[model samples]
Target: MSASHYHICSRNIGKPVEIRTRDGRVHRGIIHRVDNRMVYLRPLPQRNYGGYGYGWGWWCGFGWGVALGAIVGLALLPWFFW
Candidate 1:
């Protein structure tokens, strides 16, 4: 696992982030938690309606677990982009 990715993820808890993994897939979600081997993400609700923001979308109770070792790139999303 990349040490920088771990530190960045840990420091940015509760913030929205987009992560690109080594396998070429991208994951977008809020940083829920971080650990030695993985980072848990609270998935952003998919917007099915006409507006934007957190309030309008389907919400899942569980968060996603991504291995820090698989991450190739990660960035914090600005409020206007969410």
Candidate 2:
């Protein structure tokens, strides 16, 4: 499971993705980086916090890490929005 998560996260580096974890939490962000056990996601704005383009580039700091094993689903989005 983690192997596939690693594969998917690695493949989508720098691309936008929506990840669902076993904990029932959903994360929408750019695939920042991946490691042996974690996928870092640079989260987009939720509503009015930062909006689109807030941390949309490489200049943005590294995102929080989510354990690969905790991830149950992953998908790439066509575009980013609030």
Candidate 3:
């Protein structure tokens, strides 16, 4: 994904979204936060066999982590050069 995609998604914070990764994995959840490169998602609660609701909590994928690191490095490029 590109930076613009991240920016656009960030604007939709708290809204439901379906993210399709490059590996063809799909994740459905409510967007929590979006930075220069990574989107945080909070999974929706699911009902178990016991009739109790369980939350999957939050998750950040490996691809997103790499992207975020790259973005942070680029953002600090100017500081390092100067």
**Number of the top candidate by TM-score?**
1
User: Clash pairs of candidate 1?
Assistant: none
Error of 3 at 65 (Å): 7.0
Give the clashing residue pairs of candidate 2, or none.
Answer: none
Per-residue lDDT over 1-82 for candidate 1, one digit per residue giving the tens place of the 0 to 100 score: 4799999999999899999999999999989889999989998756556655665555567888889989999999985685
Q: Which runs of model 3 end up more than 4 angstroms from their true locations?
A: 47-82
Ranked by TM-score, top first: 1, 2, 3
lDDT of 3 by residue, 6-65 (tens): 665667776665555555556655666777757676664443556545553334442222
TM-score of each: 0.80, 0.76, 0.54
Tens digit of lDDT per residue, candidate 2, span 6-65? 998899898888899999999888888899989998876444446566353444485788
Candidate 1 lDDT (Cα, whole model)? 0.86
Please tell me which model should have the higher lDDT, number 2 or number 3.
Answer: 2
Q: Predictions ranked by lDDT, top down?
A: 1, 2, 3
Model 3 — TM-score against the truth? 0.54
Whole-model Cα lDDT per candidate?
0.86, 0.83, 0.51
State which candidate has the highest lDDT.
1
